[model samples]
Target chain A: MGSGLLVETYVFVLAVFVGFQLISKVPSVLHTPLMSATNAIHGIVLVAALTLAASVRTPGGIWVAAGAVFLATLNVVGGFVVTDRILGMFRSTKRSE
Target chain B: MNTVIQLLYLLTAVFFMLGVMRLRSPATARSGNQLAALGMAIALAATLWANHRFAGGALIALAALLGLVVGSAAALKVRMTAMPQMVALFNGMGGGAAALVAAGDWVARGPGGAAGAIAALFTVLVGSVSFSGSLIAFLKLQEWIQGRPIVYPGQKAVSLLLLLVDLAAGVALAAGNLGQGPTPMGLYSLLALLLGIQVVLPIGGADMPVVISLLNAMTGLAAAASGFLLQNQVLIIAGALVGASGTILTQQMSRAMNRPLSNILFGAFGQLRTEGGQAVEGTVQSATVEDVATLLAYARRVIIVPGYGLAVARAQQEVRQLMDKLLQRNVDVRFAIHPVAGRMPGHMNVLLAEADVPYDRLYEMEVINPEFAQTDVALVIGANDVTNPAARTQPSSPLYGMPILNVDQAAHIVVLKRSMNPGFAGVDNPLYLNPKTQMLFGDAKASLTQLLKALDEV
Candidate 1:
């Protein structure tokens, strides 16, 4: 049986609260990095998208699932890699150290 | 086995949380990103393993390989200057994926019940909107479309009508009365996409960063809806965190601009404020590169104010070199960064960071505003709106009440620009006409290089 809708709603609401608390402390200078980083984290949705790929039976279903998988993978891999590239630039130079 | 899988998903959620938390500072941001990536890997592996009984393994493997190649190539090739557009594109892809997943599930399994139907409807609606809207934002940033807000008469009314239609169709679908085919869901999805385009089209380019953040949040919420349809806990948690954090980031960006969220989303900003043209009373004074070089070389204290122009000119390296040369001459030089200096949040900081400028020399608006008065020379580089005196002096001006860097307070101000034209807000800047300010008109890079050459000779 499903975990019931109420439990999922509870998780969603609590996670929202946690997100708010954690992100509020980020300073303005780190805002871009924060944005890019969060962009990467949300790529976890790929897990949901990929699960649909295996069970799809029809030709149309397979095509759609393939497209979804492609997009989700791009979101995850590109999101994380690009975010890392940007954050790597945040490393201090000799002057700051 | 189910218990172990749940525990692993829970651990992945924890790692995602820790990743976001670690991103609070620049020092730990890289590790934070790595942690999040690791969590994504664990979640993906667990999902594939638990759902192994499903068919089409070969197709899934092929898709994974294709996605990896394309994603890694795009990530590695994108320049830091185009990071905003890259983020918009990647975020949009995630939204598209969520929408597709929901559509796939509905087609294959049918909405199981009222709750399932509602979740599917929401995923389709929000995901389609986020996807289309982010694509528009990416195009705007990429200059494929005009960065200015595009609006026609009755645009707002039409957009509202589309939203209402989408909502009605959603309700119809959720009630299971929209027939067996995907007709109703398809119509609503199309409406949501159009609505997203209409809503974002009227926001000027200058406000794109905030709009991007808002859309990112929408995508996250859409993904959470997909999680609900699939009854997946980790997807829900990850989606919620991204959604909530993106919302806060949007609010913070809007606050930094000193504009209300509603105004940014709906405001057709950046239109020419010709009515406010009377704000500036004096003619601009022009100076040459040698004149600026002489002034800079002799100054005891110099504060550099960088704006979007610096990014456009790709002059951070030259600027850094000048700073180093001046420092070598025993001159006290610092950088004054405005909160909303460039197109994206912290745009200037990242550019300067890339140029290997010392992080210590960069002071935020509040920290450096007061110090401008004591400085001998305040150098303004390709920055217009952030340094505009109209923001402080003219209530009739569009930029009124927006806190600006006090570059005017310095004993002498040298502004580097190609022309006397207004900035992104398309409003007049009286600072250009100020008696204390000298306009050094040229390409920012060429002007800086000339000024640096002269300074070296001096």
Candidate 2:
């Protein structure tokens, strides 16, 4: 138990490094799409909300979980769909079409 | 089972990383987004399986379905012009979810230890701030609220006081949890929300892109804090990725404007309407749509620069039509895109792309700036600050250090605007008064449509 927080801290620090390295090279042209796409990825928090939703033993818990799940899912679904729509515009195609 | 779930989470994190990395190019960005979505779906499925208590599955499914319909509708139906506000809304929702989830956890399980309490406190505080800040950003972008900075006497001091209270409450809450005593969770939550609104309310519309980017990073950090409370690795990974990417994007945008992050956040810019609406220091000239059309017809080369005005008028399609007509006359037409153009990064590109303009024809500032001198005609469409010669000539101007399009260097310049209203920064554009410049005053779309019609008769 004493070592748990330290382990999590190590994971957090390492992930921060990985994140900076991974996103450092994205071009300016793709920044909007990249932001939207990353916005979708952060919707991963929806899973936590859903996990909380699935164990609703009390009415209060049920409402809280449901609201969290809904917002999280909105972030996930909206973020991804919007990214896809924006990226569709960026796809190279014949000009006349 | 636990090992399998952890490995699945690990795999999801890898996919998330790959998604962002692939976005480095235009070619691979779509597939990268798809890959990341797949990771999210997988993480979601794993969470359901791992956390399901069997009784609440149906309700959970129902909530997911509701979210699916609402979110997809917003993403699918929103026009490209309004995409920045939509992004703000979505980012805010993510932050809202992180805050809500942390609160839910607190209600269900209370605090576990010093670490849990601290993580929970950070999550709620940061998440609430991101959520509220993003909401204000959305409203500003939507024009539901004033796009200009709304400031009051001692606003910064009040904000500072709120920050102090929030920090004190956070300490009390964390200490209480450590001592297994009563927590001041509600006080911290209220202060967090207030702090977010205060922090974002004074930033003007011109700085929205930077503000949105910063909020995006805050949401990511908040999500990571939620992951800490729940001991979840995938949330930490995805959140950290967004945090990093958003931070980098914010810095890039700030650099493009030649401003520091601190100034962008705290600078109550766009509030000074004092000198912007004043009489011009020099002679001003206005041109009709027909006059601009004739100029365009004979021009050997034309560069079109677009700003938020073009987006507001929904004129990209018409602008494209004008470009086509100019092309028919053997005019070499290209678009000059400033890095910080429009309300978001790559905003003008997306708007032009919607009009089916070839991506190749869009030239970034550095790539096309040198060609301005050679351009026979420079058409400024609803663009202001980016083309202001004040950036280059007037050192004391608010926009002095920012990079601007060299439209003033063109042989001929025509500006389409509704009025002489200053741009988001509320700084007067000397480019409007340049000797070679001509203003075609009207809504950008209407002017472009009229220009297209006049060209047809030419």
In model 2 chain B, the worst 10-residue window by lDDT is B177-186
Residue A74 in candidate 1, Cα distance off native in Å: 0.7
Q: Per model, state how many residue pairs clash.
A: 0, 0
Residue-level lDDT tens digits of model 2 in B1-458: 89889988998998898888888888888899999999887887788668867356667778889999999999999999999999999999999889888877876787778788788888998999999899999998999999888899999999999999888877866666433322456567778889989999999998988998998998899999999899988888788878888888899899999999889889887787675333448877999878888899999999999888899999999988887888888999999999889998889989998888877788889999999999989999988999988888777788888998999989999999999877878888878888899999988878888888898887
List ranges where model 2 is wrong by over 4 Å: A93-97, B54-58, B177-183, B275-280
TM-score of chain B of 1: 0.96
Write candidate 1's Cα lDDT for A2-56 as tens digits.
5589899999999999999998887777777777777777777788877898778
State the iRMSD of every prediction, in order shown.
1.5, 1.6
Docking class of 2: medium
Q: After superposition, how far is residue B261 of candidate 2 from its true place, in Å?
A: 1.7
Error of 1 at B82 (Å): 1.2
